[model samples]
Target: MHLPNGIFMLQRVQTVYMIVAMLCIGALYLWFPSVEDAAGIAVIERSEPLVFGLIFASIALAVISILTYKKRQLQFVLNRLNIILNFVLLGVFVYRSLTLSGETLVSEKGIGVLLPIISIVFLVLANKAIKRDEDLVKSVDRLR
Candidate 1:
């Protein structure tokens, strides 16, 4: 079983953070007026909560994978979900980046645009660890 170290013990807390972060992002998007620029980047500024929430979710998952004693199958399912989420996020960024042309650079910076890639990397690593844990479990079962 993976050891409960680092932030693994904070799953519930992290989830709460995630929910709140998503809400804040939604709110900011709703409040922001459409960019009036016609020839440059439309700065796509993001509320801080949205940024932190995403990073928090990634950290939470990493911690959960290390701390939980759940069966490998469930962990694998969670990892897959993370992967899907990452892809969706990446898609959003790609679309946004492509469309940002012909407008004033959006309020958001490149770091936010780059976050999906980082999250995807962490999710992949977490998934790999999950697989290793499964293998270890199988070996132990065979010993019995």
Candidate 2:
């Protein structure tokens, strides 16, 4: 389908993937308590500056990548950066969960902690689609 500027095609698979990744990252905001103590006190949450910045950055990257659909290489690179950012966020979650008192049981962890993994998965899928598009373009150029 055509866009106003003749760019930003919504029919692209990578665009859909990036949008899903953005939504996954955005979902963390809905899960207030990223971690809770045995007594149910919130230990870490999306409101924390570090966590907020990381999530916001991830979402921003997804949006940028989606908008840059015409530039497949840039979109791929942005997805890679987003994946790395998600990894850092995951590490932060793991570290926080591990440091909690009394062995960090699964019950103490919140759904928010898993959002990064989901986002990362979508980002990887988007990157793969972008790479495929890039390769297709290259083959077409070669055939010229």
Candidate 3:
């Protein structure tokens, strides 16, 4: 029932959740197209500099978080930071979708718009798992 140092991290549920969240973010980069103009060209394309920056930043954070699994406290903090970043991304999506000067800003709502929500859900699950593991460790310490 006892796993050696680094091996224990591989068995943690939170790691799986983080990986899933990363996959969702990657999907956002590959398949989620943003707003379209009158002629049907995408205005805020996912490949645009600003959009790419936000997406890559999120991906990097998630990757760093996964690699920091040994430090539960740091992992928890990173997950929280990632969640906040996802919220900001979601806010941007909302802003882009809303009407501006009596004209709808977004001509199409793609799966990319929902990526943040999906990523948030996965991150929350990861955090919950991490908390559970921490509680278990604390209780074990009290027993000794």
Score every model by TM-score: 0.54, 0.88, 0.84
What C-alpha lDDT, on a 0 to 100 scale, does residue 12 get in candidate 2?
88
Candidate 1 similarity to native, TM-score:
0.54
lDDT of 1 by residue, 1-144 (tens): 778454453454433333343333343244432232333344444433544354445445544543443555765665566557556655655665567664443334434455555555555665666577678788999999
Q: TM-score winner among the candidates?
A: 2
Using TM-score as the yardstick, the better of models 1 and 2 is 2
Candidate 2 residue pairs that clash = none
lDDT of 2: 0.84
Give the alpha carbon lDDT tens digit for every residue of 1-144 in model 2. 555963548878889888898998888876546788777778775578888899889999999988887788888889999999999999999898888766545447788888899999998988888888888999999999
Q: Quick one: ranking by lDDT, best first?
A: 2, 3, 1
Ranked candidates (TM-score, high to low): 2, 3, 1
Clash numbers, per candidate: 17, 0, 0
Worst 10 residues of 2 by lDDT: 100-109
TM-score of candidate 2 on Cα atoms, chains taken together: 0.88
Candidate 3: tens digits of C-alpha lDDT, residues 3-70: 66765675678988988888888888886565655656665667667668777888998999988887
Question: Please, what is the whole-model Cα lDDT of each candidate in the order they appear?
Answer: 0.50, 0.84, 0.81
* Cα misplacement distance, residue 123 of candidate 3 (Å): 0.2
